[model samples]
Target: MIAGRVRGVLRPLSVVSIAIVLVLLIYGLLGYSVTAVVDGVLAGSVTSPSAAEQTLRWTVPLLLMGLGIAVAFKAGYFNVGAQGQMYVGAMASLVVGLWGDGRAPVLVIPLAFVAAVLAGAVWSLAAGLLRLLLGADEVVTSLMLNFVAVLLLQWSTSGPLKSRAGTGQAATSESIDAGYRISTSTGVSVPIFVICAAAVAVTAILVNWTRTGLEISLVGRNPVMARWQGINSTGVGLVVFGFSGGCAGLAGAVEAFGPAGSLRAGFSPQVGFMAVVVALVGGLGALGVLLAALFFGALRAASLYLPVVTNLPQSGIDLLSGVIALLITATGIPLLRRRRRRRRAPTAGGTSEVADRPVARRREVVAR
Candidate 1:
């Protein structure tokens, strides 16, 4: 049993490790200093206190989104709209923060957080509803919503929420009160850390110890079988959608109250997209996601540190993220084959073993 569990864990970690090496080698081939790249990546993450703090800050959003991605993907929903959900969530929090100006932090902060989470969930529910109710493809709906979210973000910053007396460099919203700030602009704080920890704990419990999680896994593995077993596949999809969006929205709230005190036109640009990579790299497991989030978060901090420490362009780290995604997807072939094999298994009675099992059991038909 122990060996089985260990092997299961190793398979995913190996993929992530291989992907990193491939990315590094590719960058080196392109004329970048592999050593400098490694050093620059580590400089802020482990070698410097301030940079380490930045890594922690980045980890918060990535971890939150990674957890959500794990759950959604496990339920077979390709929620590519996490970016949009995060944006809408941030927008909701910003609106609440602005309107609650002068309100007690104790009250306004909680309210804004709820608004952010709900806004994100509502946004994601659109794709879920489209896919489940109208028989539309979730991939298309979620992907398209990303562009809409970006436009909405632009409109929010430049239109009603624009800060008066803002400089020419970038448009932004008015700052919230200091007391309402959960963390400083540098994005590190005890409360923020506590919030992140709580998120992980909650997700772990949900995925590892609950019937909903088991049902999600069952539905993901085989929807027809799950339905035959009396599992509500549609209900599972909707729940995963809401929960996933809520997690993304929570990440947005963290950004607003923790690192960013106001809504900037564009901030942490790649977090949502990178989070998908983090989930894949982490093997879509809670513990794996925590580790993956820290790795990616450190890389993000390293990206910021690289330009300052070396002559490498700021885009270098972004390349690493992109390459990791490309390679991880390449590793999906074996799993695909396994799934296909499972689909083709046959019982001695010559029935389709995979599909007929649950459907047969449902009708009290025993397999010989």
Candidate 2:
């Protein structure tokens, strides 16, 4: 029984254990102490109070953004422009926060989020419409939009939103009034934690308990078949894209109000991209997304403390995350998908229907 319980625990953690070992091996080969690497990850990620707070703070955005990406992927949207949508949302939130100074704190905060959601939905529609009307590649358009969004933020920070008091090398917006800030420089707070819990609960209900979730899954697994079943594929696409983008935007709003308190150039530099990895790592499930976000958040928090604890550079954690990402995508994802295909064969009406889908018929709707 003891050995059985150990096996059970090891089975679930197999991928994580292998990834960690590979990272340690690489560091050892580079002449860095594998012991230091392990020590640094533990101390910098969890042992210290400051590190814990940082991890929690970053978890907010990653969880929010990962949910959005999961929504898109579940619908086969492949909307990869979360970075761009986030920037747009941040821009809108900053505007509301800075310009609506006399408004009640509660009113302003919610309004900022509203503005962010609208901005992100609108930003994402640019690609969605193209995909719908012109059959354009969403991956390309969404990725390209990221560049546009970044430039828009750069212009906003350097021009209209530029704080005249700024005397630093970086471009940033004027600070939001203290009354409108959600959390202080400490970054983590009770209200924020409650909000995160509410978000997770709501997301879980929406994905598992609602009709829309089922429809999205149906559409994702087989869009052509979904259309035959009277589901409006176009409408589904629109809602999925908007929702995915809105979630990313909400994360941006929170970042502005809770942590940064002002728009800055290249803020949370790789978070949008990292969120994609989180979704994939989580196996595209709601609970998986949360756990993945928590893990990545810890890694991000430790990236700061790593340089101080050992000879490894701050980039060491970044490299480790990259390695983990590679291992997951390379080895596990295909296996996961193959298993899913087996389980889902009986789902597309019957094995005959899936097997009988002709080559030309399947080409009617191109997926990115």
**What 10-residue stretch in candidate 2 is worst by lDDT?**
342-351
List model 2 lDDT by residue over 30-95, tens digit each: 999998888888888899768888888888888888888887777777788999999999999999
Q: Give the TM-score of candidate 2.
A: 0.87
* Cα lDDT tens digits for candidate 1, 1-368: 68966875787677767867887888788898888878888886879769888888889899998898888887777787898899899989988888899999989999999999999999899998887666566779988998899888888788798888688467787888788999888888899888888888988888889999899888677766776799876788899999889999999988888788888866777888888878877777788899989988998888888898877887877777777777766774355334334332333343445666567787775543
Q: Provide the TM-score for each candidate, comma-separated.
A: 0.88, 0.87
- TM accuracy, model 1: 0.88
What is the clash count of model 2?
A: 0
